[model samples]
Target: MTTTVIAGKYVLGMREGRQALLQDHYVYVDGTRIEAVTRDAPAAGQAVIRYEQGLVMPGFVNLHAHCLRGGLFRGIPDDLEMDPWVPKLVYHILLPLTGIAAKELTPGELHAVTALGMIDLLRGGTTTLVDMWHHGQEMFFDVAKEVGLRTVGAPFIMSASNSRLGEDGNPVWDYGNDGLAQLAKSVALFKARDEGHAGLAQVAIGPHATDTCLPELLRECRRAADDLGCLLTTHFAQTPQELALLRSRYGMSASEYARDTGLLGRNVILAHAGCSTDEDLKVLADTGTHVANCAFGFAREGQNFPYARFARAGVSTGIGTDSHGMDLIGELRVTGLLSKQFFHQAHTGTAHELMRAAT
Candidate 1:
């Protein structure tokens, strides 16, 4: 056990909305978890690390981020439309980058790239990151552990969707090229070694998106998360095309489809739920489900965020970078601006509300 004192200008805890301003605090750490957080300074015999003009806060939790893609595809502007731009971007940019290939990059190269992303995240004060990548689970997990950050990694799963264009000009298939056994192996590996030195590793079942997954496979993933007592996350209602496809196939909206399929509950997080309707928002509100919106990136691609509907529906909304960039401040700032522009109301998204979403 070790004890230290830090004098900080601001110490914010999201748990109870606790804030300590311009004060000296004592933190007792018995290994990982903080044993105690006190306003009082440590005794005269104790050591102290004081900061000037610095903020000491619990690590930022990034609800949604793709670590590798963010580094590889950053700075390329995306067209608002997804029809041809998405495909072109993938094949022309991402697919050509050998660095992203799990088998292509040597241990050193992979570590370096992963480190690049990790360092940027840490510098920005993000302590927890939920990442989806194209590499092997073990490799990313190992690198994340070495960086001393909390991680939630998911194997990117896809199924039965031939519409999406991969970088190699081929259809992106489901989780495993072999079969269900491969899916089992991925889930097992994540369950086996997700924990690391920082005590911040967690495993979640990640299906790529609703359009890519078959109903049976999605159901299986939901069951697996429940059995493992972990989180189940997927992309849903990201675009109008996806919404139309799900409705046509399932005879209901995407959120409604999830509800009917028994996937609309706690521990399930749907990312980029921009196309959800008013009714769909109500269901999400009642179910205690969470929506992580990448408002900055999605809007950069011309997708409008239905914040008014979501707020009116009483849905608990969180902000994400969605692999574009992990600038929490930028995301929060953009969210506030977008809300005012979208609703034609200057008072739509207040600073306090935006801060709550980002923090």
Candidate 2:
């Protein structure tokens, strides 16, 4: 491969010991890896590309996202709150259409929609993302490889039940016994797609959420993650209804249930966590579990994560676009602002801290 040098007027990157905005820096690239970054220009006879006045920085990482859903359902059911919003828009209308799309859409058509989402992420300067969705995950992997983005594909695992609000404004669950099969499918996906992908693609276990997965199923997911040597992630404590249901069913908070099931660990990534109580945050901090804060989606419902408190409690927090149009840049800004509002203090969640979460 030919060597290339890229020069920028300003480079926002790490220098010496901390974050620094460098001036007149040139990056030396050879094939896939960056050879070096320096203030001095490259020696004579090297291919060079110069950005006269641009801020060059590392690409963002979206810690949680749903790519297919983001692409297929961007502007439907726009103005609604969380409670009626989920059942009426998501479970009733969108989810069934997803199933139909899986069966009806051609491979080319499916890949096109999925690729549009990935392209949106890349165009927005996101170089890596962790995506969880149902159906056509293998197609998602193919698109990731083609697009040259580092992706962790997690297939959604929902085994115990599919719960949605009935006409009476209460949950109606349709139970099933497909947990073991889904776990097997997840492991097989990891072995087939993740093992020999040269680190460009990876796989993780995504047990849908506490409300959808039984305790035994979650425990098995933990063991599978350990055995497969990959990350285990799930949706936890995202809504008041979920919290109430978990407490009623298991007699514990969502975080407590996760801890008891051996699901809280260094390798575990919990998405949302908007409803995690103070005690739950302590348990998360104690166990070294990470949280993916998808602020934009929740903020639409007039809610926000306790990200500042989580950061102060020593919990590693990262930014995720979740289902919010794949605008990681916007998510970062919202995360920083929401943290300050949640803590009722300025600079409580500094820009540096939120940037660390995204990258």
Candidate 3:
């Protein structure tokens, strides 16, 4: 394998079990694997990419994302003040409209759109991205392989709620989808496309959300993920309405609902626990489930998902750009600022902590 040496003015590396920012460092790569990060000079004649004034660090792993959706609705500012008590846009604006766009565009056209999202991800310094999309959209994987970007494609498994905004402007849905059938399709896509990239690609079981999926569906997805030895992800506590709906239907918060549904575990990534209660955080921490905080998306709607809230709860927290933007680096600033404000402490979200969350 070819050895490429990247010399950066500033680099993030490990030291004494903590993140350390190293200066004038050389990062050596042997093809796909990182060989080392040091100031040592590489062997003579090695291909060296020297950055005189640059920050070189680990490529980010975005824990939750919707690349195509983010790209399609890139700069539309959602300035409408959101009622914190409502499950605002996923049903009314985001999902239904994206579904229409996905169905209307030709497969090739959709692939181009997907490519556009990936390009944004690459430009934003994301090496690995965990993205969930509607079922049967296997071409998303095709784009990942073509670009050589590490990817976790979570094809959605939803029990059809036939979600829509009611005449009175409230979100409406019912338990009507066959999630197992969709799981089969995701598995098939995994088998067909997730190999041959030296494990750079994977397929995670993505249940859309608690409101859109039945509890039985979530339970079965956990079982399938276990049997297949893959990752599983879903939206949890995205809005106050979802929490109220779950409480009314299941007598539990989304975190409690996850525990009951067998969806809380290390291999699981639950997105947007922004609306979670203190008790919910306790449940999440106790279960060792990781939370993917996509704060920028909620921030646009006047909601802030403070990273400190989850991190302080002892929940393993990571950063994701979600549908607002694919720039993980930019999202870090927003996440840190929100975290500080949420905790009312300037030291709550240190630079190291924020960078650690991104990686």
Number of the predicted model whose lDDT against the real structure is largest: 3
Counted clashes in each candidate structure: 2, 0, 2
| lDDT for each residue of candidate 2 in 1-359, tens digit (9 for 90 to 100) | 77788888887678776777789998877887888788877778766788898777788888999887788778753566446324354456555666777788898988988888899999888998898877354788889889878999888877642555567443454666687888889898988889533588899998978867778888999999999889999988877777887788789887779888877989999997877887898889899999988887777666677568678878888888876587887777778888889888887878777777787
Candidate 3's residue-wise lDDT over 1-359, tens digit each? 88889988898899888998899989989987999998898888777899889889888999999988877878764775656656556776788768887789899888988898888888889999999888757788779878767999897777762566566444555545566788788777767766634687788889888877788888888988888888889998887777777888889877778889987988999998888889889888988899999888888888788999999999999999898777888899989999999889999987889888888
In candidate 1, which residue ranges exceed 4 Å CA deviation?
Answer: 13-39, 77-100, 135-137, 160-179, 196-198, 306-312, 345-347
TM-scores of the candidates are 0.84, 0.90, 0.93
Error of 3 at 322 (Å): 1.0
Compare candidates 2 and 3 on TM-score and give the better one.
3
lDDT (Cα, tens digit) per residue for candidate 1, span 1-359: 67556656665443366333434555555556767667776777787676766777666667788776666567765653455323344334543453245667677877777777777787787777877764353577778878876788877665631234556444355434432443575588666865633456777788767766667778888888888778888887766656776777788888777876556788987886888888888889899888887788767766568455576679878777776776776777788788888888878877666656655
